[model samples]
Target: MNAPAPIRLLIADDHPVVRDGLSGMFAADPAFEVVGEAADGAEAVRLAGSLEPDVVLMDLRMPGMDGVAAITELARTGSPARVLVLTTYDSDSYVLPAIAAGATGYLLKDAPRDELLRAVRAAANHEAVLAPSVAARLMDRVRPPAPALLTPREHEVLTWVAAGATNREAAARLLISEATVKTHLLNIYAKLGANDRASAVAAAFTRGILTPGTGA
Candidate 1:
């Protein structure tokens, strides 16, 4: 059987030293082919189109048209090459935008050499990969808004209030005393950041804890 073709790579970074290091590392591995090097995002985009590389090792910050913009443009133009961000910046400001702009993976420059190679291979296969720190940041970004501080009882009270049910009615339905219902309402108001029933319901809706046209 014929051996699998080597993965073509385009290294993009402003620093020549970084590009040289990555190119040499991949060159030693027969599975990866160093197709070209780019000094910045614009050059990366141009080389990517011309070389049709399987993967692009891109840096987030560059002289012109930063990596996120290049990734976005590549996606907009439908380039098949997968971009794997290898950068020093792991902050949310950098990580979120690169992923949003269609980066296939994100890895910090401090990643071990083997891990970096694996990331490039994974990106070449169009699989999503992220360095441990980057993954944590992304999870923090997407994690469901910390569950509303309200308890289940508070939620029930708020729902009833939204449905125009009086405290007495809600208490009766929930098998609780009217005084208890009032206490629950007060807690709900505090948690929802509202001063009154109307504002509480509106806030609940805005917070996505309550569906519109449902509590009614």
Candidate 2:
């Protein structure tokens, strides 16, 4: 049987040195193939639209249009390629917007060479590739969603949980029994599509059920 082809990649970075470094990295890997290169966001989008690479290595700051805007545009244009943000900044501001803009992965520009390659491969496979540090910080944007759909009681419970309260503490704060708090948490998980407390918070944030500074 024949082996699968290497995943096609698009490199979008304004810096010639950075682009060259990345081109070399991808060229060395049997699992990856560099299909196109772009100096700015607009070029990135144009190449992505035409070349249809499996993954796009997006840079945050660029000429004409930024990576976030380009990524958003690609999503709006309904491009099939996955976006893997490669930025120097790992802040939530950039990370959340990238994710919201349909980026499949986020990798800091300082990431190890192998990790960057792995991230692109993972993204091409439709997985969310987040470095532990980047994910731990960025994914928090979606946690404890913005506080709209939750009842007042539910919000109270979430706040306590966010404050590192045990079930009994949450129960005491809400004047509810521990079992009742547990039940509410179960309900919250179901409603938020969360697998655990942290996920519940992340989902809530994504759904606007919890706000960032509301102490939830």
Per-residue alpha-carbon lDDT of model 2 for 166-188, expressed as tens digits? Answer: 99988887788999999889888
lDDT of 1: 0.91
Candidate 1 lDDT, 44-73, residue by residue in tens = 999999999999999989998899999999
Tell how far residue 119 is off in model 1, in angstroms. 0.8
lDDT agreement with native, every candidate: 0.91, 0.88
Best by lDDT: 1
lDDT value, residue 160 of candidate 2: 81
Highest-TM-score candidate: 1
Tell me the deviation in Å of residue 183 in model 1: 14
Worst 10 residues of 2 by lDDT: 138-147
Q: Candidate 2: what lDDT?
A: 0.88
Task: Record all residue pairs in model 1 with backbone atoms less than 3 Å apart, i.e. clashing.
Answer: none
Q: Please give the lDDT score at residue 205 for candidate 2.
A: 72
